[model samples]
Target: MRRAIILFVSLGLALGACDDTGATGTVDAVADVSADVSADVSADAVDTVASDAEVTGDTDAPSDTSAPADAAADSVAPVDTGPPPSCPEEAVTVYLYEDGNGASNSWYDQPLGSDDLPLSGEAVSITRPDGGVTAARDCGPGRYGFLDLPAGAYLLDVAVDGETTSHNLGRRLPRAVADGAVKLVAFGDSVPAYGPAPWFPEQLETLLAPFVTVTLSNVAIPGSQSSEWLPGGSNYVNRLAPHLADADVVVFSLGGNDLMNLASDFEVLGVEDALALLDDLDAAIVAIEANLLTIYGAVRAAAPDADVVWLVYPNYAMSDRWAQYLGDYQELAATLLASKLEGIRERMGDVAGLTLADMYGSLDKPALDAFLWDELHLNVAGHRYYAEEVFMTLGGVLVGPPTSRGVHRSIGFRP
Candidate 1:
């Protein structure tokens, strides 16, 4: 029995060493042992050997018996480090003002008492210079703001009671004065002067505030024509003189009233007399050109350092209602007026610091309907569109290369 036990133990040791060939090798060895040692040896010895084989974990054991434990030990996860990112800071605020009378009258010619009314619960959309929409908030009676904005330009569009107004905001001026501000003087007729709603100057003041402080002196006369701003005229020498010396930019839009005044008499005359009326109109245009040259001379004399921007009058007959009133004569008059204005624009460009803002093609009939409260005067929407055009023109001047001489260059009506 002792000899059998020793032999069984030796056989088990040998089988364990051969286990590397897989469970099949060990099972075959166990079967051989049972067949070879069964009859001669005691059952106790065979049982003991089988028990030892089971303990070796090589008999009928699963192929992946220790895989789960091994995988768990090797699968330790990594730890994370560092803080989360933060949001940007707010840097701009815009005020919302309401116009009392929602009529299609010249907002520019209206009294100040009718404007600057606080508006609440209006949607104000703030667009970044990158063309990303930063915020769209429901603002209270006075103001709306954009936080965490990097120092750059922005566009604000406010919608109140189905009326929308847009304004550009930024610190994009090329030159800054001693006080870090620029002085802008506007001298023209009603377009820049009167406002039941905010005019171009008022809108521009807010737009420029984010970029540089602006001292705007608007000396536009509502009922005045381009001829009224000539060298000897009080509107140019007196009313506009005091502000000219300190002016950084001088902007004006005239000649519309002059054409309208001429058109009034022609409209009263029959279409059969159109040719005779057109001759008179041509002579009137010549007079306007001469008057504008004198006005430009007076402005240059007043402020030699100031950059002059001439706003070309828009085609009022482009308005559907206005076109319907004048019929075929509207296109003829508009084309003739536009041609003359283009001449003025080219003439102004010859001056050293002078540029023209051609607004003749700025508004089509649809835009005219949206902006014009009357045949010639702009409503709130019209004023907003005008302000946008002027602001972009000024921006082109303020930031464009000095060699460009403050010329906006482009001729389209952009928003």
Candidate 2:
């Protein structure tokens, strides 16, 4: 059971208060777009104009014939510096991936790309560290652009149907004590490294630099599950343990794709003279938990002192249609997750050198807008929140510099 704590990295944080920007007028003007104001606006002129009269009259001779001079656009709204200084750097690439349910689609982007792809009625401009502008392309459903970016801070705005529904920006910090460098190894479904934030791993590295230099590697494949940890049929843990072997922290966020009936969960009764089959359907969950246990153990063995944090599933409380088809799964899955947390706590209670950070309950509603890039994965804001939470829980004190040998030793080593 000592392996329990070693296998899981609980890198979640208590949600902090964030300004919820659900209202349209309140959204940040697209970052850096005002720089090339003429060009971007020209591309979007048709969408921006309500009707021909509005355009012709506004651009044409004085519309003395029209309603009172439009003062709305003329009125000056103060320029917002955007979220507090806590917001991090801009994301440069987006790996557009097909949903993990066995789809054949993938696209990638790095900032400056061809203009053939149209902007999502909602696509927005990406800002660079020096305040430059680049437009993100709407390749198609499940396809977006990899924005070319300058080396500075940035934020990713989630636009749906040509409007901003959510936005996430990253945070930057300086190195903590002991030259503390945090590296993120992404493990899970197609969402994290998938489109919109394809360069998410890179984004995390940029945002967490200066204070704590962060490195992230993506190991996400289609149809990944928690059970594939180490010795399972998929053997993901084996692939992951090596990359995380030298890190100060580990991030494990999965468990969304495994809701199937298993070999261990079937039972047939009436056994007197007739042979009966035996199975525990819930056994599948138990197996999954066990798999997580293995993952926790291997990571501990590899990273030893790194805090293995778990990025839990965000709220799907708003979907009514999915509620009917997947409601039970959602509820049961949530319950199982809650229990797993408790179980991990119980199993790892004796280990003095371990930590588990839960983000599900810690994330607040206001922060949720920034955290979720979609109903499932985290966007820029969400990733920033994650970095902050990870810093606070594991890397907070290390902000100064690296000094201790224990810092280098894997958490699995006996002190």
Candidate 3:
């Protein structure tokens, strides 16, 4: 009986334990597993949320300085003018510089101010680059004789002494302007003052319209050279002094006659004496260059502001004789030529605003053919070509007017 009571109590204890476990919660195997999974997923969800916030914050943290890097790069570009203007039709001040005294008065007229040059006479016409002419009338003396024209760009051709010169007419140059009223003084031998068909200065005036107060004055002489620009030796000084003084820009074309004259002198003296003569000639060149410097100095003194440029002779290689002469020069001529250009370059090196135009290199066969009205003097066509070359190639090289005044005078230039 004791064993039976023990066994029954044990059974009742087991049954009660089972009943209590079932009553405490209606436990399901799937329910328990789902509850455990949900708890784990909730923890994972918190971790993922924190991770996403960190990623988002990291991406946005450094975006503030990006714009500044871009801003700094754009600050250095230069300003650009979209399109250059054509000639303007208004009353313009035109300055004419002519070579020679008495009967040789070949008028080289260049227009001034922001207006178109006149074309009312047989004196002026329009020509294309390939060499064609449109007949026009002589607009009389001193009037830019054209009206009711658009403002863009045009090439003006003018005739002088039977040759034609092509001038680039535009309201303004593409380059930046140096000052308000830039004065341009054009000087040279017979060429600048005389073009074969179209007069160069008039065409030039037409070309440089609407851009500046172009005051071009020709100080070219018929028989001047690098050696002739001595203080008072050539009329160059007297004629150029005042112009230089008032000029904001000055252009000089010379050295051809010097070489031509010297070639004859060289033939007479022979090479041995030529060397000694060259030494003397070099001294003369120094004097001439010095005089030019003095003239520039005087110009600065007068204007207290001007830009100066020297256009060396155009390529004479166009001449068969010259080409042969250059060949015989061998190393010595090259040396001397290099030295001459270099010396002038060096001496003029310190001018406040100075530039040298390499007129020698730009000459081509067709161009040369057009320039030769005679063997040496430029025809109207030649002058026009020169003016075009100069306006296009040289206008950018000059620094535009001096800032300070010079105290010296060109009057004291002497050997």
- Candidates by lDDT, descending order: 1, 3, 2
- Measured with C-alpha atoms, the lDDT of residue 101 in candidate 3 is 19
For residues 198-313, write the lDDT of model 2, one tens digit per residue. Answer: 23445446545644446777676645777666643455545665676666555565555553222123222222111111123234456666776777776777766554555544
Off by over 4 Å in 2: 1-177, 180-183, 198-201, 231-238, 260-282, 315-354, 364-374, 395-415
Local distance difference test, per candidate?
0.47, 0.35, 0.37
**What value does the lDDT take at residue 169 in candidate 2?**
14
Name the top lDDT candidate: 1
Using TM-score as the measure, name the better of candidate 2 and candidate 3.
3
The clash number for model 1 is 11
Error of 3 at 105 (Å): 35
70: Cα error in model 2, Å: 25
Instruction: Identify the candidate with maximal TM-score.
Output: 1
**Each model's RMSD to truth, in Å?**
40.7, 22.8, 38.6
lDDT winner between 1 and 2, please give it: 1
Provide TM-scores for the models: 0.52, 0.42, 0.44
